[model samples]
Target: MSRRTDNRHRVATICRRATGLTHDTCLRWAADGLITRQRPVPDAGTPQQRAFEARLFAELAAGAVLGLTGIRPARAEPALALHADRAREVLDALLPRLDGTGALRGVPGLRLVPDGGSWWLTDLVDRVARVRLLHPRPGWGPRPGPTARQDGGRDPLWRTHRHALHPAEAALLYGRAKEDGASWDRDLLFSRTLRRLRLIVDAGAQHGWVRLDTTGAYDLVIECCCASGALKLMHGLRQSALAQERDDEGPGYSGDIDVGGACVAVRHASCGSFPQPVAGPDLRWVTC
Candidate 1:
């Protein structure tokens, strides 16, 4: 017999938010099917159920919720996807590289260097293909003694950090690129970029990031709300001969670009998507 999917949040799911579990632990659990709730958390599932989840969370807030590693946490993708909607403001600036899917694609006039550059797109597709999870047996909650793998471990975006690509794994994905140092670990650099970009984003109306030295004829701002933003921004500098960056064991595919003696830093989100830039007075060009 089948049952209706309630899509309610659980205690373990709420706890993961405050605890800040490591990415590896999340991945392992996702692989093992530990944190899944009886029903999947809908993107906009139900207001009443969600509010109740919040109330239950408050009730358990005083207890030891963080240490319950056995329970799976709630996924952040639904909220992040919601955030991605606000990122559409910069869609026009990046139109040059967008394809039918609204994803990033190569275009003319911008020569992306660092060879194997196109591979990033290939890698993007590759990573998305890998990394999957098992789902829970809706309405049944946890299985008795774990007869079969069905406890919410299979949800694609099970947790916010569901990405399958990393420097080490990405290296293997690129094979030869790993040997040359072009495809190095980028998570750390990506983290720093995320922080700086968020600073720019949070400082809304200030357009605080655009205090560059160049006084070009035109001012443009580029920022990302999805992964494509970073891809499009980096693609601009790919073919430029003057692009200055560290390719030796560096992510090498992205970084700041210096144009006409002006330094414009290009940054992206750490986990999933990159956002577009915000324009403010005195700031000419901005890209997130």
Candidate 2:
């Protein structure tokens, strides 16, 4: 379905607000191709299109942040794209946790590291565990019994953690031309600018997270809403099939998985999906 959204916020204004950059600076970045010209959405556009714009905003702000940090236009644009691509990968697992108005209700903070780094995105939250309930149907009367498969077990039913990616502990690499042993400029302008951008991102202004009012106008909520809808549809089909199983019926069933916003359907060749289910390894304990 299509909805009408406010289109009056200028791109430069958003950039300025996100990174504290002057309007002129943002315009220069746009002119120099640091900020690619994202397609404009009409007042009434599909939810998906609006969601796309919200995603674009992240790249735009990231580019401006990179540029202001003294990275040249050529390097900044592609770097921003890489960051956005990685962020998009986990959105399907993310969207269900958001509240109706797109505000983050009870999500935890995330820790994200820049690309080409050791920890690009942090591991899943440790406190909680996920399990899938499975029932086996026999030929006689009711199914054999039900079994529980925890996450990482062949396949487990999944639910999202309502966590915000803010207050994120992040580390970004700043490539320097100076020799490894030599002292580099610690107080470079770009270094200062990068720190400022980090603050905005942490506070949820740059990426529009956590806070209620601004979040409705920015990335996480809108993008999450659209993407979450698709994910719900995919899970719904598989869940419905599982809910209707009777003991007299066969052992297998068709299941769907959400991958990059699209549904991929799979079926088992033998009795059913995971007939002889193999349990995954146990979680290893680690101290931070």
TM-scores of the candidates are: 0.22, 0.19
lDDT tens digits, residues 224-273, model 2? 11233323322332221212221122332223322222222322121121
Measured by TM-score, the strongest candidate is 1
Off by over 4 Å in 2: 1-14, 19-25, 29-47, 51-150, 153-288
RMSD for all candidates, in order, please.
Answer: 21.3, 24.5
Error of 2 at 229 (Å): 31
Candidate 2 weakest ten by summed lDDT? 131-140
| Model 1: per-residue Cα lDDT over 169-228, one tens digit each | 333336543455221112222211221222223222222221211124211223433345
CA lDDT of every candidate = 0.26, 0.26
Reference-based lDDT, residue 223, model 1: 41
